[model samples]
Target: MVMRWWSDRWTQSAGAFFLEKDAIFFASARDFLAGVLAAVVITCWNLAAVERNAIVQASQKPYQTLSSRYLYKTHKAKSGRNIHDASFRVYRSSPAMAELLLFEDIFTITGIDTDGKKFDKVSRIEARSEQFDMQLVLDVNIDVYPIARTDKFTLALSSTLRLDGTPDDGVFDQSRKKSLADKYEYVMYGKLYKYDDDESGGAIKIGVYVSFGGLLMMLKGDKQHLGNLKLDQRLYLLMRKV
Candidate 1:
């Protein structure tokens, strides 16, 4: 009987403690529910904030509302371009860079057309650099398109960087002034089908496609020779200097 009485007292005491804390527990529950509702509302609102017209609309806003508008301004429909297109980069070279190509002996390679037009040096060789010109070694390459194909021929080849007065890679580490033409394995492409002048001496036709390889070197020749390089770890071809 005593044990049963003590058990009833313990149960009553536990109930009283729960009643006392009920107010605080209910307040906490309300707070937790409000927090959950606020978080869901915020997430939904944020998702709606992102839109496809974001760039165009955002670009029109003031600096206070959208500080990043200036960068995306060009993305507008009328602009139709990107900011990166405006600027570019290139490497530095030595004053005497390196003579990458040198024709020690260029002989009497002459020809005449049937049209009564006399030509002196007729054997034309095509190299990799778009700016390469044996007559004026400076334009050997540029940042423009090197490979081209017209009604005549499709030319393609490469050359190694000539490291002489400067480093081969054209980095601005050491400043040396000189044209550096390093040794290059000159390559040329020729076609099998040949071209010959008419009996009346018309235009002379050339081969369809042929390949040639020779030892040509590059030194620190000129800095402005190649307009811009494609950036290395690639096969660069140079032409033989006749």
Candidate 2:
């Protein structure tokens, strides 16, 4: 009888010990799960805050209309020079020699114009660019498109108006086909006749010259911007006011 009573007491002690171990295990598991949940909540909150900040920053940034790939230059006109007094001797030379040698292909492109001066002809205007502090002399057909002083504009030289970068047949289409020129107010067909690099104001400047019929354009600036231009290539000059 004494042995049986001792066995019962040992069984009770064993059961109590097992129950205490189970309670400790459950408590630790619950605490671990709660920590995990708290970490997840904190991480989600941080991500959401970051996204909200990004949206705010984007909204505050200025909107840019033109893509850098096709844009050749952007300028605000400082002043209008005297067209009559402005020498066209540098740009007046005929482009026929270059035009006669190359075949034409069209591709997508766009830009803006800044300041203008009416030349000897009522239909023509001579202009310059101001943004990059570069030397620019541009001649446009005022009869076709008029540009005033202190105007802000961008210019692009493109081979075609196709957005897909495919070459267009050298034919004018009046169809519903959308083109890069649609975004611009003034458009002209021209050929890049010359490209030159020279030192100006203690800096190296690259020059691009193009002729639209008899109208001419000379853009001289940093090479990083004008490096894509090719000589004797047919291009479309697109311009719009900002």
Candidate 3:
């Protein structure tokens, strides 16, 4: 069942709008929501420290065009002129296929065909200012695979990601700039999952092993050791589609 209710919106738009952030609640009691809500997540958007008010400020800027007002502004800026914007639109949809616009400050596209083939690519992204401007023209490639119970376990790899840039906020870059790179990246591999349902509470279990190398390494250069990291994969007891 679906329900609609009214609440206060902090923005000056000054009208009631539908709340699209749905929650999937699992219930242990029969009186409440007895099962988990099937809120599927095909995409995700991650924003930094910016708040709801910052987007409102950006929306009112003179740069906003007449035709772009309907797009959803998902990203936010913390200080000065740094800002980001994104929008997701369904470009095409059919009985068993779909194409979606992946908007995460940057823009990209993903298409899933009826025959289970998928294509993902990232194109041009623009960010400009009065003093400096940079445009990301790199193309992104994505690959996916569906694994079943019998799939064998694989090795893990670890690596680092480095970010380097200096701000122009009245500070001089005297060649001694600091980097925003990753200290270390950790990785783990899980092969088996075990679930039990009896009078004792239902439980799900999985077997996992870790490695500091291979595709699991997400750290930058070996400047320092920030200690071992933990995995961040969600768990679910998946029942095979018979």
Candidate 4:
């Protein structure tokens, strides 16, 4: 009878121990599941917030889609090979240049053909920014769109002429619907080939180079002015004498 009594006590103790252990295990599992659920909720909320912000930005400026700024100073192009070949070769030394390639977009002509004519129809123009003090070396088709020294012009760079900021279709659009091009006098389409940063001057300087069917352009300035540009982007250069 004593042995049986002892057996009953031990069985009760073992049962209590196992019940307590099971309760602990279930409680931990429940806490882990709750943490995972909370994390998922937070992640979803963050993604929704980002989407809302993007929508707001897109709607804020529906008509003004191009990246633009004003430029006022100018300089002459250095005499050398064709502007296209010269700019390409300079950046081609970098592997990124081989892989790929605007404006608040205004500039004033400072110097024109300071060296000499590189091409009969194309004249290299040196220009400067009125606001940012950026420098530009551009080749214009003089026979088609004549630009002279001391000319004040607004230049805009855009991926698409559409005011709605759509991606370019890569086909020449004959549609006469008013576009960003309609507001400009001269326009050229090109692809950005290279982007580089130079720190030799103590301050960082950025260089952006593009080619419009061999008509070349180089823009150099601080990061604030060129930060929006991306490599290998197709761009439209729009200009109007302001």
Clashes of each: 63, 13, 15, 21
Lowest lDDT sum, 10 consecutive residues, model 4, at 83-92
Q: Which stretches of candidate 2 lie over 4 Å from their true place?
A: 1-64, 67-131
- lDDT tens digits by residue: candidate 3, 1-242: 12222223333234322222122222234325323222222121123224455556645432211122122232223442223334423232222111111001111212223233333431211121111111111111222123222211111122211122222332223565432111111122321122222233243222222221121111111111112223442211111110
C-alpha RMSD values across all candidates: 17.8, 16.7, 28.7, 19.6
Q: lDDT of all predictions, in order shown?
A: 0.31, 0.58, 0.23, 0.70
Question: Per-residue alpha-carbon lDDT of model 4 for 5-92, expressed as tens digits?
Answer: 9999999999999999999999999999999999999999999999878656633322231222311222212341111111111111
What TM-scores do the predictions have? 0.22, 0.49, 0.14, 0.57
Better of 1 and 4 by lDDT: 4
Error of 3 at 139 (Å): 1.1
Candidate 2 residue lDDT tens string, 32-106: 999999999999999999987875664343223323222222222224321111111112212431222121111
lDDT, model 1, position 88: 16
Better-scoring candidate (lDDT), 1 or 2: 2
Model 4 — TM-score against the truth? 0.57
The alpha-carbon deviation from the true structure for residue 166 of candidate 1, after best TM-score superposition, in angstroms, is 20
